[model samples]
Target: MKPGLFVAGFILLFGHCTSSLVPKKLTDADGLVIRTGTSAGMCVGYCVFDYVLNGTNLTLTQRPNSVQSNLTTKTCQSTISQSDLNDLLGTVDLATFFKQPAVLGCPDCADGGAEYVELQLGEQKHRVTFQYGQTIPGSEALVDKLRTHRVALNECK
Candidate 1:
């Protein structure tokens, strides 16, 4: 066999092996919420929001909201309404999320006008939308975050 041919075959085999060994971690959810902050040049802020799926309904608690204080490195707490809390724990299907219109001026180019996962929590259904093209990067991260939250919720139950 030619040396060049042998090298090409080995490269192809190695590439296939490496690709197959990479575990796909995105199959653990039905949908995800990708939240991205407005970007300025090299600096970018990103967050992942996930839905805690509790059977068919999600629970919303009236926890205190916090704000960072400039005087002290502590947070200030604020009260929230029950309605507002319920509105926050909703869940939805992954397909519907990918069908909604994208918000204008998304910081993450990956999330340019992509649909978001709509969740039905408690008695209300909330729409969790993401920027288009972000279904891969942001979406995946969002799914993982949601999964973590879901596990925590399960533990509480």
Candidate 2:
């Protein structure tokens, strides 16, 4: 066998075995709530975000700081497919997660956002709060993902 072919065959035969050796992902119930708040000028007080899923229904709401001197809240709702919901579930482990509060938050910094994250899986629930710019230990990846989801969910504007 040619050297390249030998190497290719070895990889093809063994590559599939590594997957089973990997640990199974932690799965949880199907609910998520992401509340984000920001503070800048007296004009822009805060921003709150919420996303909830029940079966095929997905509700997203964004209510910015009442600094506008207005009491109007914006909300958008959409129906999500089962496949999309499954994809969301595959993204994080609701179990053994959100056990610790985010670190280095509540700085007196100006023009920053705070995040209140809550996840529910079956009978399990975890909620954590931290500033957006601060580091969240043991959940940096999850925070980043939530930020991205925040942006995407923002399109409901």
Candidate 3:
């Protein structure tokens, strides 16, 4: 075998072994949290937004895209009850995340911008990178809940 091949194989094997040493704490979390980032464009900078749903509280942050004249960033927040959070979770159990596709594939993205979704509960956390409106199955329910309460949230567009 070539000398370069031996070095490459050793590096790959070593990297994998080292990665296994890192513990996955998110998989053991007791509470549930969902974070999402949405953006459009083949590249970067185009109406970027982020959201975090923890316990009964919701927060939204947005930043203008490159095309936009305003460069300001905005943040908004709202709340939901623990029972309501339960209802949302009932629609989509946490385990479903384990079976989630690595990429949700945004069908609506004209040319495919970018979107990221992360779900955390206890020590289990799942993250997906997809396109706009193209998230995993069962996510719509949670999205709907957020939308229904969007009016109460600040800085979330």
Candidate 4:
């Protein structure tokens, strides 16, 4: 092979390989809460919730206004009952509790953006939003921590 052609091929291969290493941001809408950031890769799907914790028990209510779709302009409405919230709260730690925004991807739907979730906590009913994707390394560890917290709460009863 010609020296020039070999160099060109090497450059092309290097570019493709490096591109794969570059992380892409996953953005999604949670009703009025909108979050955007980069994730390790593309997201397949997600869910959003509004949660309130009382002692070791929690109530997670799905907010209809917190729905965002990347695949369709249409709005989606869903609810999470108080009993369901209690079950989820019992399983997770309320102090470290966080909500995830809905995520979707389709060629026919909108693409690109961060996923957001809004939560209302306590009697003050403080509202807060959380965005996922560009978090610290070890996504699994964070998830496990949350899961363990949930189990602890469940044991309280």
Candidate 5:
């Protein structure tokens, strides 16, 4: 067998194995609430964000130092379509997401920034925290979408 053909054959054979290894998609999203937010330690003026998601309603609350007289907490409300919510839920692999540790990396280390994504189902809950701008392995699509939504909400006039 030619060397190139041998390599290609090997790849094709193993690549097929990964098909079954794909994470399972979440099946039930009725009681699911996904919360995500970001915070910075050494920053001023609205350095903290708290996002809460319930059904199609999304609420974002931003705050700076309470002691600082110039900045105050701001709350914003937004609604996402059910279709959009379904799309976001479909990107999550609940099995893999729940398996992740409570803290993935050094979140907020060195005063850079920190972010967290949490899932609540019924009475069970799981949360993963990582450095800001870092992407989780299995839930990349969901996280990216949420981050974009947060940005849009913050930028809203």
Candidate 6:
């Protein structure tokens, strides 16, 4: 074999051997919390929503215009099935998800709206904020699941 060919082969083999030394993030459902919310700067009637998922329990808190005396914050309780929870968890690509920046696109600009998703796995916490209707490139599956859950929660009333 040529000298250059032998050197290149050795480097490739060495790199492959050492690649396993890096740690990888694991997705553990225990103590995992997923939260999604939306807000609009200029709106009326439940302009803000906060949804929290812990295990199979899901809670939603709705906030309206604070200045309006007639509008009051509301809280609702709901439970998601274990299968549904598993499905949601399965959509998470930890490798891609964790690498995303904290914020994406301009959020809540010009009162268009803003949406955010936060995930907590044990001690690790990550949050991504993006334009109201836009989906993060790497997290589309997870976000789609979350959006479905959010819609279900909104129809709880």
The best candidate by TM-score is: 6
29-69: candidate 1 lDDT, tens digit per residue: 32322222212222222222223333334442221113312
- lDDT on C-alpha atoms for all candidate structures: 0.37, 0.55, 0.65, 0.32, 0.81, 0.82
Model 2 TM: 0.57
Where is model 1 more than 4 Å wrong at Cα?
23-25, 28-157
- Per lDDT, the best of the predicted structures is 6
lDDT of 1 at 76: 22
Candidate 3 Cα outliers beyond 4 Å, as residue runs: 1-29, 42-46, 66-70, 106-116, 138-140, 146-157
Pairs that clash in candidate 2: 29-121, 29-122
For residues 32-139, could you state the per-residue lDDT of candidate 5 as single tens digits?
788999988888778889898888889998888555669768888998888778787888777778889888779888787999999887666789999999978898
lDDT of 5: 0.81
User: What TM-score quantifies how close candidate 1 is to the native fold?
Assistant: 0.22
Candidate 3, residues 1-157, lDDT tens digits: the string is 6999999999999989655533233221246677767676544433676778887778888877767664677887877887777776665545556577877655335776676767775566788777655556766675555445543553555
Q: How close is candidate 4 to the true structure, as a TM-score?
A: 0.23
**Residue 80 deviation, candidate 3, in Å?**
1.5
lDDT of 6 at 53: 91
How should the candidates be ordered by TM-score, best one leading?
A: 6, 5, 3, 2, 4, 1
Error of 6 at 137 (Å): 1.8
lDDT per residue (tens digit) for residues 74-121 in model 6 = 899899898888888888765577788999988988788999999886
Residue 83, model 6: lDDT of 88
User: Residue 94 deviation, candidate 4, in Å?
Assistant: 2.7
Backbone atom clashes (below 3 Å) for every candidate: 18, 2, 11, 15, 0, 0
- What TM-scores do the predictions have? 0.22, 0.57, 0.59, 0.23, 0.76, 0.77
Candidate 4 C-alpha lDDT tens digits along 74-129: 22223335454344334332233233222323221233323222223322121222
